[model samples]
Target: MNDKNDLERLRIQIRGAVQGVGFRPFVYRLATNLGMVGWIKNSAEGVWIEIEGTRSQLDLFLLKLEQEKPVHSLIQQLQASSLVPLDESDFEIYPSVSGEKTTIVLPDLATCSDCIRELFDPNNPRYRYPFINCTHCGPRFSIINALPYDRPNTSMNAFQMCDRCRTEYENPLDRRFHAQPIACPECGPRLEWWDHHGKRLASDEAALQAAIQAIQNGQIIAVKGLGGFHFMVDARNSDAISTLRQRKHRPDKPCAVMYPSLAAVQKDCELSDLEAQLLTASEAPIVLLRRKANISVLERVAPNNAYLGVLLPYTPLHHLLLSALNFPIVATSGNLSNEPICIDEREAIQRLSGIADAFLVHNRPIVRAVDDSIVRVIADREMILRRSRGYAPLPIALSKPVPTCLAVGGHLKNTIALTIDSNLFVSQHIGDLENQATLKAFKQAIDTFEQLYEVHPDLIACDDHPDYLSTQYAQHRSSKFPSSQIFPVQHHHAHIAACMAENGLEETVLGVAWDGTGYGLDGTIWGGEFFLANLTDFQRVGHFKPFRLPGGEKAIREPRRAAIAVLYELWGEAAFDRTDLTPVQAFNAQERDILQAMLQKELNTPWTSSAGRLFDAISALLNLVQISTFEGQAAMALEFALEHISTDEFYPSVIHQGIFDWSTMVEEIIADIEQKTSGAMVSAKFHNTMVEVILQFARQWKQKRVVLSGGCFQNRYFSDRTIARLQAEGFQPYWHRHIPPNDGGIAVGQAIIAASQLLKRGG
Candidate 1:
């Protein structure tokens, strides 16, 4: 008995990552089912909806829209207003309108359950289709070329849709209505196999079968995935694993092991509830888990590491390939030690031919190289070690909104961050920018994020260090965009601020940032630092005592140098006579005299209060590692040394005049070495000492909350124990979650601090 005049009309505007993720189709279905009349279309700004119906029906539609949004669509803001109702007849999806873009770009997602089922179903049209996807999952950042996300604006435009797919695309009733990446085996990219000689072996199903057989027969296969090529080998084959290690020149670094199912992962490693959930999450990432002692996985895969990095297949090709295999596979990035992962087929074959026996590639292009994200579960929380693949390009919701800004990250593990309105997007891991390839990748990441968001940045933030390439890049951009304000944040402070930003901490907290090196305000190198900080500023209240970084940056690769410095400070010239010293034994008399003079006169040696260097020094003293081949090899070796043992005892440490000293710890380690202390025992004691000394410092600070960040915290053995001890002391401690603890996360901190400054200045 409702009057026609009583019928309500409303116009709704929704923001966030609403496009290319089935938002419009969902709206169409809900409105049509509610017997309402409306026209829904995508705009660059967001989703716009006009609906006419009875008040009750209109009310139900709004509630359901909020409660049951599309799986991958994140609703940031929703607004509704009354509208004049004409005699609108039916619900329809209108053509996309290109307008000013202000919403979040949809991030790349793992395949959904429904789409996965469809991919494997023999009766389905997309059966065994390698590029199988729907609105709920698949490429977003990598494939997209522009906003108002449609197939024409994506790489999918290369393939014309067939009649059946066209019908689904045009019909609002279909599940894949307007699904941007929708494709079939006939209309989409096909898999092909090629030998190292560049001869084509097979195609389609035969190619996949060939790939399976190649991996089964202890051969390496470079398989192209959503982001890049994964050089895969049978994990159970120790010879295959060793061969891959030798070819890749990655001797001890752990590689990700891909299993077809949770059962397969469980067969080799113990999975906690959180770990299992993370492994099977929609944005599935590689999870680092403790290996079962008696597991049959090749020992060479992880070597001395206590944990194995494991992942379940996240793409259609992976699903199809693993379906034909029964063994876990070692899936490492297809590249040499320092280069970016291979994205192009030709590039992969050219670069990975020495490592890969055959190549399983596709015609579809990967617009960007996104590495698989790495994660570990600690203290019932998900800690992201490396953010990429499934979890990146998604905006981090800030505690307070700020103006559009960009933060160029630290030098070592560079990544860029852009904040448009309230959404903060941190780019994928853009490897060290010293090399031309990585620098190009860095530029591409920044440009890609800029183009994806259409953000005209109003502010810029970068590291304080003048020598860092990232800082220089920011300076160059600042000069290019003269109107944008530029701010430089201290490096270690940026680390702590990043921890604060991710944890939503607006109040002052005790931040203990431990890393390798950062340019301090006093023109010295600071890495092990304790600060009282909020978003705006920080005070250095406590820190590790300074030690000479002999030969400057060269000491980073030679932990023996750092050890020599510490030993010299402890026992003078007698430090060289220590019988257990490996570096002293190797050094000729002249070389030893020169090194001693350099330390004494401080020639080319800079001082560093770095916890990372301390770990390096300890590592060398223990004879675990003297010279590092990679950036973190020595420190990582130190972490792994005590992986098999548990200890509560700690070496002695002293704090005087707010300067924490590890001289006592160094001396005791030397004594332990002279007494032939076990490597595991010394390593355990060192880790425990660091944990104890930091807790003592936290007690001195008297802050109820503590924050830990920087590259040093990436060590699970260190972070886990530090977090545990802090919790025991009735103190709340915060660490990185969705972002890494290392320099990769510093951009978020820089951006946040800059934004806070802008807000404070009312900019």
Candidate 2:
């Protein structure tokens, strides 16, 4: 006790994902074990600690702190200096300090192994508890109201801890120590089951049983989960799936299934090492897997989709609900078509009443609506299809620090991003801002992020598309802030930039952008594009030849119209009578005449080089999809057509003057169909042709790093094939893994691109 001469005190501040992840408890255990007196606490900036210890002990403490930090805690910065000691007698954790929060908020984690074991353990107090969670797992961002993350500011605030749980929370050696969302059945939220008419059916165990019974009875139930509600039904029930699809007005969009166990998932789908790892990872994202031929899963759940989107039960409630049933449930987002996920209990019951037969309700309020994150293995690596719930709020690190900025994202798959210095915090998947409710949610997200991260935008970025709600949001932002700058980024450019930003690559690279549509600089619609790009600039090096859409937006929904345009371009008047051109057979004489006139006069017709439109046209010509019920339905069908096919043949095309001439390919494809070519061979060759086109650009640009992005890349066949071909040609092809390759990931690119431009202007 009298070793004062050798003793020292230090005030250390740590930043980065250091909150809601047991960081303070980690420090407490380490300090107490080392016989050091200290007080640790969470703050807006990060963790702050005051330690008094001998020189050698302090040195050992620092070493272990770096080497043995909490598994989920990522220490971005740690600053230490000698300071006056508080003369503390024992290590302790003080209440979190609130003000300007900079420490990262943790994403909601999937059930940890220990928690999973305790869930099923008969001897455990929390056995079979629907809300069981601990420090290592359970909800975080989805439940957080604000940060300096603490129970008082989360959805868990209403659930006061019982004595035993409180003791565990206060004990540094216990795993639940300082866990914000810690709860057990005794002092936690309970469940309720309600009929569509708002009559309560049952409670607790009975409620769960009723929910499962409803599903087994071929009824769709809106079940509350971690982030929001999910529409649940027996995956094997074709009638229920069709009924739900009809009620939801989502005729062909694939529904995600939640299996009870890993064994069940493996039995239904072809699993690979990477896919299996991703499915079971802490995020517990829905992974697209090749479905087994003999599985009882109804095709109605995912018609024409080559891969089934599947996820394991990630939460205690999910585990319990799945445990009560023998079959997997279709756990799709609780929203109509393109609406933001439903979070409020009453709102869910009201809005989803038409689609869901019953509601599996809960008392705990969700702070935000988060759709389940989605991923797929492409070229043996993970590619995020949708980012939300279990993989959000945690910022993506930039190559260097930049000023505060906000990006409002695209009109479809909207996700807003905010940057404070080097950390780029992209919000959870905000649904397409087409409806008032979704737009309100998007606005709320902007406000919430501004308050949470405590940063005002120096600039805002969005798409150049004038009609996009995101563009309007940015315009309004500039007007409201007055001093804020606004950057209107091209759509395809943003798609490519997102992948590049996530990879932290600043150098110029070859970017291949293909999706439904983007506003081209020359007053035409663009989608198939190749660019030589860096953060600050991009040069359009190559693109698909523009073709007119017979009825503009109408052509997007009706693939037959796009096919008519392609055929009209190819054969003029002769295309209408071609007996092999079967898409024409689906149209009436009047409709055909009107479509032909629309194409000839180019009235209400817009030209686009979109690879997506091309896919739609090809699918229509083959009579696979004459009219689409969903945005990518035709393209999805085309990808599905590749199943059980092996071919090296491809329709030939040429590139001249930076424009890819697909006329030869289109003409040949028509001729092949007339010659009775199989759809599988045509689909395989179509995919192969895309690979060849990308390879041509890769070779011509001479950039080793090729970035493949845009919604078109969401097709597994196209993305995987293109990536494999590029890699084999000795090019390092960068594809999206965290942010979606679709519009959901576009905001990140918009943010970084604007940041780079701002830095250049020294703003």
Candidate 3:
């Protein structure tokens, strides 16, 4: 009570996810209630608070601060120091400091329950509001242009709140208080429709209804969403799904579905508890749910797979659109084959003109493009396939902080990572950067992440592939930071490192990295590799035997060539004369002759140790797939066929020099085909043989831990069975949890490895 005579002041610095997630508002409320006089502001460093009050009040304020932080905010540091008292009357919230470099950026969040309730409430002013949002929901990472997230720094700056919203913004009791994206029906963006010819429709609602009707009548429509655009069609309409498949040039890859609600998703597929939780999480990623047998959805949507990727509406516009459309819709990316998604309206019309019958779009600009996030529930935990939308810009916390660094990811499924101070932020999916548009998108995304996080990286890291566009970009950026070192990490090593980082492993583990292709350290293509790796160093222990990649990358698009190579290695010229072989019409005479010559002379052919190529070889050997329209179509088809086979007995195989004699597996396949063994039986035997061989390898090492990585892990049948079998043997098996098991997570591994190297050097 005698504080007036002997006043004490305190300055506090709070860091770690204390910005752009209602941290300031919580502070304001706490300070006001505690009868403390101080001002809180957001700086480039973190949240800054100065309090001048009685020691007891200050103690109470600090006590409540940590215990009562905002639901999503994580307070990593809270330091307080006494200072001279500044006699102030009331506490206040100050404007954020600008031009201060930092590494903090917010993650995009799914629509909150309150926003959903308000969207459907007929009496609410924001009823049917396409952009209804508050501090707890809506765009954060995607829309932000700068840090210290304020309205003016986002795309929301264009829309001014009405008087009522302004009152709510000033009222601490209101949920919308200081909400940056606060908008109403009158002030926010609205949906509009356009025909395939780019002509504007007369009525937005009527045009959308007409589009829905067309989808019901077997036509495809391109629908714009918060991040980018999606090409949607009726999931149950086989003709519509087939038409979309043909138009998008996607022959075998599965398309995701946008169900009307959670209940609707449950009606079509069986959901585990974890699947249900992830489906309803704030991220709202598309969850791969196992389909109930004999479901009525069109076969073209997922082909032979037992699971379907399903998602609930994450945006207000999506909710409204789905509420009017009664059936599930095939929601896929709106783009041409092998291209990035179209974000601009003009780009959408120009790029998607041939595929979409109509376009449902909006006027709000997407400052940065983001793809929809994809996930699957494995072993009762969420495994991300494509981490974007609600997941991007959210820094993955590291066990140890490192100097600022940037990691340029691989050529395919490109994504970049930036680390400043202790936090690391990974960009959204940038697609394959082989094309100009995707490369431009990659550059833009990098610039966006750097700007928003205020990061000026002191070092740059890239893949060892000299031909990769990501490598070129890193080289170009290196000039700007002359003092910054550029570290080139091998692609497969990065893959193992990524898994190690996600699991927080400190010791060496045997990493089995399997994929399609990566430039190996030995100047060959390496995909099936076994390495004893930690964050700092790795030693190659074993790998698949090398086979000539006939015609290089061309062999990947045509599985028959891979078949010829595998057969040639096993049976020479007699490989083609095998009576069980079926001549597929897809490979013309000239193509066959060239492949034969290439295999014989090994002309212009590079060798690769790739498990994906082995899968391709099996697909062609069985005449299951002659051509692959997507990257992993042949492999997926093979997995599907394998699912039908029974695993009652193990197929015989020989292991020589740590390499499983795959020739024996091929011989067994040929023998099975000649004997007219059931396709299911052959497939089951094949899957079992591969699993047995991998287990045998593990047995040889007796390694306590196994790290499974690479794009191949996306296969649920293989990953699940492998992990289960290994766990039964009392070994701890680790897979990517926070990020993808594919190349999308390579940057994470690169960062972890680079940080470890730097720490060792410093020590």
Candidate 4:
């Protein structure tokens, strides 16, 4: 036995992503195995533990704790100190205690391999069970209603565990120990099949089989998922997909396909080692991969796109269903176009009745809806195009701490951000705020985050645009919190700031923000812009030449309008007679006359330097897309057309007085079109010219670090080439990886900028 002088007590406080991840059990087992006596308990802040042992024993305990923690647990902060021995006899786990909140909710995880094996094993009690989960995996953020991450605070509280399951839960050696969503078929949620008319058709196994049969018959089945619902249909069923497109009012956007396994995905798509790892990762996000040759059967799913968004089975139900079938299924969000995804069965039925023939739903209520995350490999790195579901509500580490703040993101692709200490919590994709349903969902998401984090913001940040729904909401909320300060950030600045924040850059960098549109500080529309910026402030250094957008917002939906506007700006009224131009031929004399008048009188014409509008104009001139059916349709088409084509040749362009004048490039493109040049060559030349413009500016500015942001960077071809060129030219280049390059990342930028400014003011 060790002497009393050799014994010591240690008190440890650990924070960040510790709860509901089997952390306490892991600690209990470690302490007991080391012949130590201690008590561990969950707390509002994190986990608190006290252990008494010899000095060497305590040292070994700390070492093992650091070396062999749970897979999903992240120890952001840990403090251990010497204390007087409490004379404890045995290791024990005490109940959780209440305190000031500091911890964050972990993102919902995809089902784990252990659970999957148990699900399919013949002798396992949960064999073929759809709701099987253990401590290492399953839902956390979606079903959670409050903090401290216990079963009573989650939707699982509605179902008390069976005696057998309870014994496993209480056993520290078992994998299901303290797993909040732990359940078997006899004690957990069950699936049901319902008709579009709210009539129940089948339950449990029958329901799963019925959904599969309906899918094989080329019928749309709305399946409730971990975070929300998905509309599942056979990817090869062209007629069924066409019907879904027609009913959902989504004609051109590509749908994600869920294959049975990674090997299955490799057969149809070109998958790299990294891509395969990402596909099978715990997040299980939809990864855009290049399609292999001779895969025409899936053409209806992705249309003319060169890449197919693919995902593996993430949930047990998905696995059970896919394993029983040979064909892949198209899994798209279950909602009408432009609306938030539905989480409730009744809501899914009411919103998707006309589209879905049957509904496969469960009784475990999702506290909030989260759409699937979308990712792609650009510049040999993973870029998250849409952050949700398996990748959201997880805090982004910040470099510094500031006053509590809430950032209301832009109108399109809205997502709010909340700050606690040095962690930034960016919400999932909230979609466009045009409809009441989306707007209401946006508010509810904010409310849920605020409640979950217990954050009463002392400041609010929003886009400077006066009329944007997000800005208006910020203003409206400021009245409710009279003590809260409101800070309106410029739109393009937020884009750049978001990039800087994502990269943890505090120093000035060349910020290249190119997107479809943003409200400029000069009362114009800015999209293509360059700024010398840091987190707190920015200086506008360069931008594209301004051009008129005829009919304002209407021009965005009609590429022909932007095409005509560019042509008119070049040759004035003389250009209208050029019937050889596709945009000119598409518009009749009356429409041309009206457009000319709008440009001349400046009525309802907004001047913009948007790179996205420029791409739209070029697409129209190429006769590829004269009208857009979706937000990024024309631009995506432009990117698709230039996929494999390469050309070092660039068109003529000039930079004078911080303005990139592409008039000569436009003239050259028109000449190439008149000369019957290939569309690929023209697109290559245009892309080359744009890359050269940024390069020339970077050389002139003498900035070694360049940050690229905005929606234009989402084009993989452009981003990959630009990054390669920048690195070859001996410059550090940074683009978004975790956050989106679009407006979905605006809140993160706003939050960081606001926090930086507040720190400067000593707030």
Backbone collision count in every prediction?
Answer: 0, 2, 0, 0
Candidate closer to the true structure by lDDT (higher is better), 1 or 2: 2
Report every candidate's CA lDDT. Answer: 0.86, 0.87, 0.81, 0.90
RMSD of each: 2.1, 1.8, 2.7, 1.2
N/CA/C clash count, model 3:
0
Output the worst ten-in-a-row residue range by lDDT, candidate 2. Answer: 573-582
Q: For candidate 3, lDDT tens digit of each residue in 270-353?
A: 988889888888888999888887666777898867779899888887787788887789999888877888888888999998
Query: Model 4, 460: alpha-carbon shift in Å?
Result: 0.6
| Candidate 3: stretches off by over 4 Å | 1-10, 33-37, 51-68, 84-89, 202-219, 479-484, 583-590, 644-648
Clashing pairs in 4: none
Model 2 vs. true fold: TM: 0.97
* lDDT preference between candidates 3 and 4, better one: 4
Q: Model 1 over residues 313-410: C-alpha lDDT tens digits?
A: 98898888788897788988888887889899998878899999999998877888889899988667898888888877876888667888899998
Better of 2 and 3 by TM-score: 2
Compare candidates 1 and 4 on lDDT and give the better one. 4
- Per-residue accuracy of model 2 over 582-691 as CA lDDT, tens digit each: 78998888887888787778799899989889999999987899988877899888888879887767778698888888889988887778889888888888889988
Q: Any residue pairs clashing in model 2, and if so which?
A: 44-101, 44-102
Q: Give candidate 2 misplaced runs (Cα > 4 Å).
A: 54-56, 84-88
Measured by TM-score, the strongest candidate is 4
How far out, in Å, is residue 417 in model 1? 0.6
